[model samples]
Target: MDISFGETCGCKGYSVRSDILSEYGPSMANSCGGGNFVVFMTILEAFIRGRCDLSDPCNRVKPHSEPDYEYDFIVAGGGTAGAVVASRLSENPKWKVLLVEAGGDEPPAAAVPSMIASYWGDPAMDWNYRTEPESNACLGEPEQRCSWTRGKVLGGCSVTNGMMYMRGHKRDYDDWEKSGARGWAWKDVLPFFKVSEDNRQIGTLVSSEFHGSGGYLTTQQFPHQPAIAKDILNAAEEIGYGVTNDLNGDNFKGFTTAQTNNRNGSRMSTATAFLRPASGRSNLHVMLNSTATRVVIDPTTKVVFGLEFMYKGKKKVAKSSKEVILSAGALNSPQLLLLSGIGPKEDLTKLNIPVIHHLPGVGKNLHNHVASFVDFKLNKENATQSLNWATAMEYMLKRTGALSSTGLSQMTGVLNSKYAEPNGNHPDVQMFFSGYLAGCSRTGQLFEPLNTNNEDEKTTISIRPVYLHPKSRGYLTLASKDPTAPPLMYPNYLTEPEDIDVLVESIKMALKFGESKILSEKYGIEADKTPIPECASQGEWGTDAYWRCMVKVATGPENHQVGTCKMGSPQDSLAVVSNELRVFGIKGLRVIDASIMPIVPSGNTAAPTIMIAERGSAFIKNMWNWNKPPIVHDHFSSTDLKRNCGGVRTDTNDVKIDIQTQEREVVDWHKRHVHL
Candidate 1:
């Protein structure tokens, strides 16, 4: 490996730079080519010299003095949500928190902005899960089973995700509240979102009223803007979708540059953002490479007291005096719940596990953002190639360039399709724009690359039209009694006729963006029709029939799985957890992750997942009667309700809902909850 470094920052508790690298090799004077590489080497040098490196301080949670010690809170799965929960709970000196993770540390490449694709299938970083064979979608994928990537590392999916930060539309949360999730409306949860965010791009990219600062999670605009992004934004605007300066601000609809969980040039995952700053607390302890097998509950009392886990080839038990929180994410969280015999009684009995609590919703209501990728080949003269010396030098010298971005998808658009919500207030389809889709070596890192014979990878870009509010629901079940095995996931993509209709319409809308004068005439880009041989053979290219065929064959889940452990009113039979996130019929146990969402939000699940954790921690603290100071809300005040613009949301139980009236209800809710 060809690696270089400059002078060290010195060792008076300083970082490693020249001194450590000089003893090993000649000084790199003014050389600054590999910023991420140098940082990784600095940490390695620190470990060798028996010193601590603070670059990602949250990655390390030194073990406590006692090996088999119990804690006030034992947070299983140190992924996106669990990391925040453990970090916040441990703030009180009286509370000892234990965070258990199934994966190891995040690698150096994870910090590099463009290398996100590489982490998709890496066993060390990804859980490498696959959905059961689908009936209506993923026809062109391997074995007709869509690949599902979940982060198994410290930050969970936050460590392996595209790093795009998106809070779902206001109507999304309003629908949650309307569907039995009291206090989860947009107004109620906005504070939690702000509480966790340290928005570095506020005022410049987004408004300060809608964003937060000095918070644990750092979010900012991508430093390097791809030229293709500008084209997409322009074309979207030409097609009537407004160009939103801040997609996460007042109005979430329209096209805009994506805000990501990145600071400077590095990916700022929750493991680094939330946990790193809190790692020094003596009450916090993090255990990596430890899998939680089951939550030990008292059979008669039905209360969780200890957790059984596999650590270093041995099974051990760690007791939690206060509670055992499951932040294991959408897939693993429900799997752990079933493994501990807290699921459907028939399933648990069939698996031969003693039933502690018969919660039928344990692994029910599984769904994700179903999407189709439309590929286009841009003019070679204006296209970005696989590798360029200019970009490498730019990043090395100033941490700004193509290398400083989250790959090609730099801009996104959220808009309502013809088959939109009843009130026509919220957009159901989200389009992500990737400048160079297939040209790069890492093109196929996350999802399957477009089927194309072209040798050049940089000339292609893909417009991903995602069905945000999918109606096709799936379920998960235990594949085996063994705790080490993965659960059987049935995404059942495109099973619902309505879902298929939405996807088909989304494809048509996506074609308009490509046909817009800005992209076709000005940018000289054309739809890559040859990749879809079946669609091409059927009839004229870009037709409804042709696109429908392509969508069916190429459509896959966005991996934003949620609702396995559904949260709802107690009267709701499918409700596993309550609005407070506490599991029904079980004491000292809570589900504080994406699995608790009654419906997957209108955008990426990362931001909402973090918001869930922040609120969950607050709820837990309040329940315990902790005398912490009240959270301040001076920067952004929640005043007026701006309802009647966004659509209305009818109860989820309404079988025959009036689409128009539902939209109106949602709009009214937003008006009431509207912020100043």
Candidate 2:
């Protein structure tokens, strides 16, 4: 019998072939009792309706059309940081802000926490990037290429990620200051984090000082979790690991239920938290389905003036009267700079593009957290897994059920490997739990049950042990001059043998949890005994050599890529932006996103990126003197201008003199100190 289903884009008003359904009715009934099939269809229909209602206009940011040719600020890429930066900068009611996003608004399915993996390879929602074939890693995958999934939607990867709201260790920020990112110490940037956070469990589940309250971004644990989650936490404690309620609070090293960026069982992306509140502002305009191609830089003056973009099959330019900020994410932001002739002179000349500034650090220092997947089997006869019609109904009516949470996947564990400092503040390894096998089918169906012939194998679960601080660095270069083309990525996963050592240690540590008395007695947990076929020749199955081989074969390069456009002092040769986030040799331009991170944080990157946006926005406001008393034109002299413009004041009496000149002088000062 032939059966056909509708598109999963919005799942609204979609139809199935009636004749095919009728033809296959009896066979489907025989395969899985008639009542069961009917119940499945009923739940499917209800899910479609709920998704459509959640994606309605009232829950999304309304796209703006016919934006003016110029604005006070033009923010490129309305992702995690871009959305927050644009929203905060537009608060003064006097500045006109334009935000350009390459993708459309998020779909209804993105709101469902359990459906996060459904968007992994979907071209409509993900960038679908793959690392250049690696010889040392990803041997099990086709052609040894690791899939790097970045979001193409408005909310960016936050719409496609696990939604874990991790802020990394405080020492991570102090290290940033020591690495030339001055003023980025833990104490200096904590307030910006609080300004964007609205933790629901501030006093009860988290510390009031470490967490925030009464802010836009709502964060809390999912309302529902599987029964197995408690057992997993108990197992961690039994294995001599500290268990805490809050990973983001005082204790960074521990095992606990994850705090997610969720609100009432739905995802609260940066677009939902920041953009939705500022949607009604006349000063803020969001341009969806628009791709920013290049930064328009004045050739002789080396000052950014506007942005070139593609919208509706036509090329257009938007002028920035004040600044053109690039928050296009780590991958795209550096690619845009290379396309705009702001990269190394030798490489630009090879591509026959005239060099604008010859900044050598445009696309260097790339890295990400990498992990290895380890599988285990649980006794399903004793476990209480509730992912059926009754739970589906419960979620549809009251938003409380297994479907409202990620189950055991909502738990995380952080511990220090032998390579890490023994201090609890610096955990080098992290663990992620997946309650079920997560993958997308060829037909795009999501969250399907694992198929296995063995009854015991049907209850398989996975734990991913991630190496948080990797020394294996990679870089990306432009594939061609076309803006629509993807950059050539060289993630170089596991290139360093030290990285493999860390993964092997992490894998050993995770197996201890499976062997703990609590998990063994309560859940009947056992590690999959099958040895990796590719690693069989390395050593004994449980030996360190065998685990090292397994790491190379099943490499998991996480989505937390950062440090391509690292921020540092003017004296640092590889610094793309200064401590203030301004491009060293250019005027009216700054990069405020994950790309500026000198070192990737110890955990997830979304929360820190938002903090960077908040801090960077404040820098822009202070530099422009927003809300400060307007400089009295009659008394505005060179001395006042010098103090405001970093001592680059012009001697002209005209108060309306082009501020661009002063900006150029400031850039020149930094350029002299920057190693060419």
Candidate 3:
């Protein structure tokens, strides 16, 4: 009898019998073609090289000592942005850094490329956050509360995120500049984005000027390109949508194979990319499984001095001599600020917590990328093993197969919705096409199985229509005085009529994919064969009301929440932080995370979040003379500024500034560091 344990454990390629291993030893390795060995060795070499760089004075990191108390820099929340911030800040050997993480390290299984889906809700990796019930969305879910999954591990959401390396539209940053966030236009920040990327898969297919080769993050195309990706590309082109060879390149519009932060079939999370090399630094202290309960600020002076955190079930305080940066994610960063008495005065007064500063923007402006799924059941014979024995053996023995892919959305298409302004350059809707049904996987907190009649268990194809820029803003509030208590997240998705109209139009546009000759004629499958039967009971299949009902019942977040602690000028009453990322009312305290985005970008939040950290790090370094100030470009000269109306969308909140104070501060800093 053929023997294989199952998909989960057996995929690593081992047999319970010793005799089997001995028989297949060298010969099996040869048959598998030594591909897996080469891949492993290449990664090991890169890691070693990164370690060597860490020992350099410009990038050195010293391990934390047990007796150490105070640090020059305290970076709270060792997540995607936090890891980058902490690692970069500790490069100066004289400045001791402390990185506090609420989660432990990424597990061994988290390394498996195909097993990426398994880490979403793995108690070992996820924070397991859930949002409060919404009146307009998540109608099919239990209690109408949607699952908001954030990575609790060292890598943060990068550990379990879809792993797409998208930089969003150039207009996004230009809009930030037009909205009062100077020195943040696409050209001003492009250098920093290039500085963080170390693209490994640069060949004839990539643009040399647009990509960087000597950065920390490793970005490349997935080893296994699903057959559906090619089919979809062809179909997309036939339908008149342009095909972009590289989505991260100059052309932001079009359908293409998604780029991921993976190296040699393994997920290259911020933990592995940024933290691993710096983990050995004596000056860099990383406290894992430690939750920062509050930022210790002098209530009277409104100055941050240290932090109180829970570690190993014991409460402890760590002092910061220079500065305390909050790199915690969107939810936790705002939540921590409130717990430390830095939120709205009214809310804090009601909670009986002394208000250090009445920053009304603490937990407000919470929003996310909302998506609705459109699935089509493919012919069973054509279905790939969503995860089966052969694919497992291929991955285990060869390290090159479907198992090596990102396992999330494989292809992305950027296009304008019907409701989009005519002749607009920016695409309002982004569609993700995947071979497997979106929520087919039984595990993971984000996967909510669709209520459908699929007793046949046939193969499925799904397209997720995501609204790029949402207008309906939400707020996160404290459930109680308890710091450990999860914040009550009210996403307030689809509250706006325009948002709902755009999404409904997006679904109609995605329906074209199913109707394409490549999917229906070539594949011999019917477009409406695998209908979301639940919606059929509501109304006729193709009606506006039917699709609207389908959208309401199936609408879910893409997990790209941002803009809670918006970055703006002090004059803006809702502004929580200055353009430098420093809190307006507090000294020695700053927030560097997705929460600081005034308006969510047009694409994935991960890449932009990393870019923010890179820029924020430079800002801090320049303040201490550790690095020279970056030469910023004139935002008015950009093509985006000339073609499109400057500033943010009419529906979005504009980033306003206190220009006189900002100018004065720049002059003062220049005088203090006149030697430069």
In model 2, which regions exceed 4 Å deviation?
1-53, 380-386, 436-456, 627-676
TM-score of each: 0.84, 0.84, 0.81
The window of 10 residues in a row where model 3 has the poorest summed lDDT is 23-32
Quantify all predictions' global Cα lDDT against the true fold: 0.73, 0.76, 0.71
Global local distance difference test of model 2 = 0.76
391-448, model 1: which lDDT tens digit per residue?
A: 5445544556766786567678898888886787888999886654221322212332
Report the C-alpha lDDT of model 3 over 7-34, residue by residue, as the tens digit.
Answer: 1112113313212221110111111124
The true-versus-predicted C-alpha distance at residue 312 of model 3, in Å, is 1.7
Task: Report the C-alpha lDDT of model 2 over 6-67, residue by residue, as the tens digit.
Answer: 21222124422212222110111111323434455443433433332234333346577666
- For this target, which candidate reaches the highest lDDT against the unseen true structure? 2
Task: Output the worst ten-in-a-row residue range by lDDT, candidate 1.
Answer: 636-645
